[model samples]
Target: MKSNRFHKQLCAFLVTAACMPQAHADAKKMWVQGSWVNIRQSADMNAKVIDHLSTNTPVFLIAQKDKSCEISWGISGHGYIPCKFLADQVLVFADVATENSSPEKAKNYSPTRAFWIAPSMRGLFNAGKYFQENLLKPEQLNLENGSVQDRPEPQRPPKLIRYSVPEFEAMKEMMNKGVIAPVVAFAPLFSCEQMQEAKRRQVGSSKDEFTRSSNDWSAPDAEKYPYSYIYAHDCLVPEIPKLSLPKIKVSYFKDVQKVLPGNTQIEEISAKFGIVERGSVTGSPRWALDYDTYRYTGAWDIGSYTLTLDKPVYEHVIGRTGLVAVYRWLPGIDEEPFGPSASCEEGLRNQRNGKELLSGYPKVKDALLWFQSATPLSFRTAKINSRAYLAPARSLKEGEEQRGIKKVVVYEVDLDGDGIADFVQWDMWGEPEISGPSPLLTLRQIFININGVWHPFERDSYGECT
Candidate 1:
């Protein structure tokens, strides 16, 4: 079981208080009373760690059982916690306590998303905490989970951004209508298997979207259609217009082109990612972090970029080295990068890491919705079926992950009731790395979805799919 560093005296006192219980009218809101409380997957003491609600953190109540209650403070904070940790009312005014407020957000800290339009999901069954929050009090976290090992100073704490009930309700109403498969825009239905085949080819070519390389886009198709031969192999890269790095020289972009000019720096670069997170491609195979620290969206004060395929072709990276480049994926390529490539078997298995991650964030917040989009290819500027998915914007290739950033997903779905499809959205949020990985966090850029568009719900969301 995950243990806390603080004394259990507070817990004991709360237990005593719980016994003398107040009225059963059931509180409308509950605030975490201790330094922090863990949300569990099951009521059992040893079930699984879900998330932590900081002291004085408040959440709207869903249900109350014996000792634990289901609560969601909003965004990434949703799980079952011991009801004893909360009181009947909000402790602090949220306007003053939230660091995510527009005017209060820290310089280096921004929600991992560029946009967070409220979602329409209120009446939906079990629609996790898409939008929710409460006031909070922050304090240092010892992080002494097990054996005492010195973690470096400057530890990153979680951030809580509160959203208005109206924005959330508005978004919720839109989502209740439903989502449509983006593939509807494409001519042929591209299966996930076909998408995987395209990716395997990119690795074999040792070329990615950013890397300088070329490919034969022509492919044989089982059933030919008007757009059957819409071969694609390129997309709009970071080019020069999108970079907003810091002054520090990113090894990858140290002497590159306009992408990573001579001297570049991000206001704040995580000790993690090292080069992967840099706007410039500065990664070498041996030098890069293992399969875990795959680069997610990098959103700083300058604002984040939409990591999407410019057109209809799926995006792929030639993961041969750290300087990864996006690839215009062509299904049925039947090839892999010649040198430094992973077996298709390993690659396919890696995608499932998303499942493992959700269980890690055991509250199962913002599960997932994947589909194929008719993306445009840079090479021919032709549309083709591209594999795409909308997952929570956050990811965790490391542990002790900082929390609070919410991922926003603007998508189109056909409301079953409406018949014809229309565009609707939800500000997706969740984190897998909050508790880190069980066993131990590993090194590897485990691909859950393509880097740009499909992001985790919350920052640092990771889990062991194994």
Candidate 2:
């Protein structure tokens, strides 16, 4: 009787096991379309999340449901994911093109009224020649016996590559053929911010350092147009003319050199000051093919000067003097601006509550020190340290009261390593408070200890009108 009962139980167990649903033998692989897709335990909206999958994650489709489909979750078991989130193929971002399609394939592309070259074709031509030339070949000198040397090779300025109108039209037409499609369906994988970071990393490093390419296609291709990352991705598309081009020929003043004599030459400043942008002007027969626009931003230290010239004089300067080793007139250390005049001091006195918000934070201390060391003009631009001014709360909308962030408090920071608080700055924003439009209040000031009395020596603010 016992043996018969055991046999009956074994038979029941075998039947239940056989009835259980199993994964399909020929499961098809699908990629996760969106980032951070949830893999749920059951085919329900509120089902427990078993795992998470990121964009382009591969998964095997096991079973199909009404709204969700079961997928093999790693090695342990299967989980259900929404069918809408699964893609039959993976998408390609500009940051991740395994094979770089030739720019020449889009040879029929045309340039807009603002530019001479097809935007799509800018990456194929090297723009780094303007900057990299200074680093590659410095002034070559010929020497013989001591005190006897040949005149140094005349400095060759970086030259811009000129593309004709026909070439521009060809490239534009080629892109229209759909050899390469822009990744506009989703957010840009290689954002301007990412490109800036890549360029920053290449600074001071050798040309070989910048040449190092990643096999990982997901990385941003900063190498293509080292001077301009924007050209690498979006230059293919024509830009809408924002402002009408100047009708007259524009040129930089030769007096620009006279005003700023005794200039200090640097390896590269074009990234900061920028280079002359070349674009074609139609209906103006006087405008030559070699004409270019000059944005003399900080070129003469008299604010930013912009002019569109008929002659290629600016291009000649770039070609002859190279933007990389261009001469700059830097202000002397004594000439650096320090603030907190009587008026500024009077304004800051009304806002100072004398409260310390970030007393023991090491991160804030490190950041302040790093900020001071970042640039030659850091002390002049110390107002950047104030969070209250740089990052103000959004204005409350209609019918919305008690909007978050009521008051911001300023804290004392030790700018120098003297262990004494030398500067007063905004550290953080306040918690949510009763709000209509929150008052924009910010304070940034440095103090000098004179006879044990803290006197405001310098101050900086963005929009503290009072």
Candidate 3:
């Protein structure tokens, strides 16, 4: 009889437990009221703004009887909103403490809870203070990079010169056609002697044109002859006549007759000029120029002189050490002299220590001037590519630990749509070696397109690839 009574009580208890409301299923609902509210599933997604709440506008919240209450809006056949969106809403529910006092007392009742605010309300509230702090006040918005005071002064446009009749006509024609054309002409200057010669020759047939003497030439005057004269129609200008100067011939041969003042044998003549005596004729001879005594001789008079020398002249003149030294050091050959001997000496000095000699020689200084002329310099940029492992989805139940990435092989990426590969970054691994409660790694990969290729964006010195 006692066993049957215990069995009946156990059956009754099981029935009561089965019919009791689940803690999670028991949740409360609430309505939203405001000037404007934006309904959205999550914070990141766009919100639907509701301007006014009416009888049909149904918005509510429900709190789970268990830990972490779940909230939603609308009714069946309607979409569910995220619980976090109605964090500010109130919760309502019937008291269930009277029905399951013994069981509730025996079970632990610590509850986990979460809340949400309408996305539109959150954005406005958060943005309101920020806008007021940053935008409403002018003083707070003023930026100081030192650029306001350091700006460069404005530049004035260049002045244009007035054009003459013919010049104006040419410029006008070019301007009408939308083309740029430069005008260039020669302004001939002459000296007095040249002008006189031109007049004597009666070279210019037209009264408007006459050749001026070469001596009459002067520095061009910008105020007077501002530009070269241009002609229009069938006008013609006379050609300038080239002036010719009298030709003079200077000989460097031994003047034997002048030196000796009498007839002398070939042996005596050779000895007098330091001429190397071969069997019958002298092979090489040394001679000096007496610049003071030398006079200009016309070209036609060169072959008239007959040279003769005496034995005494040979002993006294050719044996001089200075003449022998000069002939040995600077022997005249058939080839033309490059320039004055002084120029050759200067070139040698420049090759030795040019910087030290720059001040002494103005010509050398000008040649070595190091001015910074505007020229384009070449530069290069490097490109790179990389790959990243994505984060796994979070789950409620614990299982086998997720497998971490083994190796990351980064290849060059052509992010700019260019086919060429620029650079590569490889051997990447996640940070924070061990994984358990805390995340193993917070990984992020950045890429920058430079010179038409994607490069790994690095923060330190290694990032600079130029």
What's the C-alpha lDDT at position 51 in model 2?
A: 58
Candidate 3 on 370-462: residue-level lDDT in tens?
101011111111123335433343343567454433234344432223344422223333333432343332222222223332322321111
**lDDT tens string, model 2, 1-466?**
3333222222211235432224458888776664345678899979998655544555678878898988873334478899998878863332222123356522322112101111222221211112222222343211100122123432222232222333223323332221211222112224323433454454424544433332222224543322232222111101111211112111211121111101111101111122222222121111111112211111011121121212111100111111111111221111101111323232223221111222222112113211111012111112222222222335668986533224334444432333444334332232213222544333333333332333323333333323
- Worst 10-residue stretch by lDDT in candidate 1? 112-121
1 or 2, greater by TM-score: 2
TM-scores for all predictions: 0.17, 0.21, 0.12
Better of 1 and 3 by TM-score: 1
Residue 87 miss distance in model 2 (angstroms)? 1.3
All models: lDDT? Answer: 0.28, 0.31, 0.24
Could you tell which candidate, 1 or 3, scores higher by lDDT?
Answer: 1
Give the number of colliding residue pairs in candidate 1. 71
Looking at model 2, residue 172 earns an lDDT score of: 30
Report the C-alpha lDDT of model 1 over 1-466, residue by residue, as the tens digit: 1233112212221234322213223536655654335678877667697654444444667787898787655433456888787787533222222233355433322111101110111111112121211211222111211122124333332332232343223222222222221111112323223433554554444534423333543222322221122333222111112211112111211111112100111110111112111121121112111132212111111011111111222232212111112222321111111112222331112231112121111222322222111231122111111122232334567664534323333232221222221212232233433343332211111111111122111111233343
The segments of candidate 2 whose C-alpha lies over 4 angstroms from its true place after superposition are 1-24, 95-466
Tell how far residue 425 is off in model 3, in angstroms: 86
